[model samples]
Target chain A: MSELLHRRTVVKELLKKRGDMVVIGGLGAPAWDITAAGDHDNNFPLWGAMGAAAMIGLGLALAQPKRRVLVVTGDGEMLMALGALATIAVQKPKNLSIVVLDNEHYGETGMQRTHTGYGVDMAGMAKAAGFARTMNITAQKDVLRLRPLIDGMRGPLFAQVKIDAEKLPLVLPPREASYIKNRMRISILGPEAALHQ
Target chain B: MTTVSKAAKPAARAAARRPRVAAPRPAPAAPKPVMPAGTSHWAEQVHPMLVEAGIRQVGLVPDAGHSRLIQLCEADKSMRIVRLTTEEEGVALLAGAWLGGEKGVLLMQSSGVGNCINMLSLPVACSMPLLILVTMRGDHGEFNAAQVPMGDSTQAVLEAVGVLVKRADIAADVPEMVSSGLRLAFNTFRPVAILIGQRVSGAKDFRKLTQPAGDINE
Candidate 1:
């Protein structure tokens, strides 16, 4: 393995100035990574449904065209629904960014090697799919450079952040999908959210 | 339990006037303007309802039963259609759409409904407004035995997973059936399934199908 980067540090840095952004975390490790970064009311962390993180982000970006949307998923999770990259690129929502925390394994299912480890270039695939910005970052400085593009640039951005393939402490978000969803909804829409339509 | 949309009530939309989704596909070999005779009008009637309700996102796992509806969505610029490789993605996609202040519908067939079973937990648990339109196969003179099992069990399976099921066996009943399903989904913030009977789609001609009997044997 060529000098693996740390997943937590990558996620934490991406979400550093995450003001009013709606973040969707893919099922397993990425969900844990977001919780580790510190759960917020705007975070919709998936406890199940393996390959939906990116498409969900696309829908949210389309619905709230002004609000920035970010999806954080793992390589295994990203690989499961790579077709979504094309779909997101087709819709081309400028406020959306999809980041794959590539540890090169399915951390939740057992540390089995994923396609990325075998040299499946996800950033290249995103670029081919027509994302405005695509990057495969291995170093912290590159991630630092990427932070501004994710935060400030007008984009349908896709980034694959390569991280160390190692086990980390589980920081599970609230498993109740309803509570998490409603909390996020209430945060974005206010207390009168449910009462309205 | 409810999320009112911030969507502007754009002037009374005509079936002819397209609003958004700049035609993505290159017009495929001069399109036919007419609907085929004997084709189910289920999609014709329901497509407008979705538009009226401001459901602009349409997701599907293509099925012969929903061919016309899919075509209608593609033609109707008001809807942004996402053709999914699998049916489960629709559930997550629609949930995300609703949370972001828009409405969506998922169109699939009975066999594809089975693929969505586990993912149903997302809408049920989150109380997301999920509108599912499933065209029924394997019921009433099913030519293929493979479709029979899931077709018969679809309603029960959907119900067991907490989705309220509605059936529209006749073309005339399709509008009311779909409208009720929409009301149940958005007003009450529940997931509702509307099953379109094969009687409305008519049975496919196995003899005309080019696929030989040996091609799909397990």
Candidate 2:
């Protein structure tokens, strides 16, 4: 079996060529991962909200319709809102993708083991829920394959990206929710969005 | 007798008739659904106003209190209604929608309000527009004891989370309150809660909400 990839490295690879893609980072580590990938105006990182990243992705996917929407969240966070997998599939926004970093622990809450570590299958759930594309990535090479697939826009896609369970340095993104929101609005809708903020 | 194409009737009838699998049942003639007594139609009244105010997205968890509003959003071609498995998800959906230059509202019952305390922080933290239409439970002849505590404390709980609470107990007040809520949320960029009173949503008849899978003559 190939070695499990690092979360930051995996996120970096996925986000490297994300031009104009709207990236939604789930609370905690995934938010940090997006920042480590180089935070941009299009990045709307969740600082405190849990179990919301994917549905938020659904809303954005429905709203933008044209732009690619990516949601990066941890396994714990993903589990907290598993029904979203079904909801997203029903909405079937082809431009949206959910990349779950399966580190198998609640990294923010004292590293307690989560359901994924005990073999709860999120990718299987997504596939059963009718996601157009589903991936369970365990190696570095598989990460490369995703780049082209996401580019194809044959989504709504679900990827359970298995990564090392080791805790790493916290490379935090912007914490201010309003600031993160306004910048993302400006990026997506330009000056008109700023007036609302 | 009805506006919807008979969603709730068959289910309620299906629940009423029992042990139909064993016996050969006749073709059930569905009875005309009598709209609940004193039907406020508050939800029906507010649906157009929300559309008029440029609000389109609707995120909700299933509840009898929000049945009409949910149906209204579902039927509208311009509005996008998202059915949430839990109430807290609506908070994040609205936040995402607002950032994407769209407007939306959250519909929930009092019991679901407890599920949202943590996530509600996202809107308050961002100062984003969050408009919630809550149908209260545990008040005004509620049958379910479990819903009582959350219902009694819904306002205080919402206030503690920094939401501006506006309660409407009767049918007439709902439209104006909802409009004010939209103004507070969309114009002021603040979170406003329109707590629909128990009497308005007819919280007492909640047991008659959903029936079993099979059809019945009753």
Give the TM-score comparing model 2 with the true structure, all chains together.
0.86
**Predicted complexes: DockQ each:** 0.37, 0.53
Q: Please state the error at residue B178 of candidate 1 in Å.
A: 0.5
Over the stretch A84-191, how does candidate 2's per-residue lDDT look in tens digits?
A: 888888788899999999999999889999999999999999999999999999999999998778778889999999999888888888767778888888878887
**lDDT of the candidates, in the order given:** 0.85, 0.86
Predicted model with the maximum DockQ: 2
List model 2 lDDT by residue over B33-113, tens digit each. 224577647777799898998887898887887888888888998898888878888888888888788899999988899
Q: lDDT score of model 1? A: 0.85
Per residue, candidate 1 scores C-alpha lDDT tens digits across A46-126 of: 988778788888888877888889899999988988888877787788999998999888888779888988999999999
Worst ten-residue run, lDDT, model 2 chain B? B209-218
* Residue-level lDDT tens digits of model 1 in B28-79: 7532223446755667888888889988899898888788889988998878
Query: TM-score of every model?
Result: 0.83, 0.86
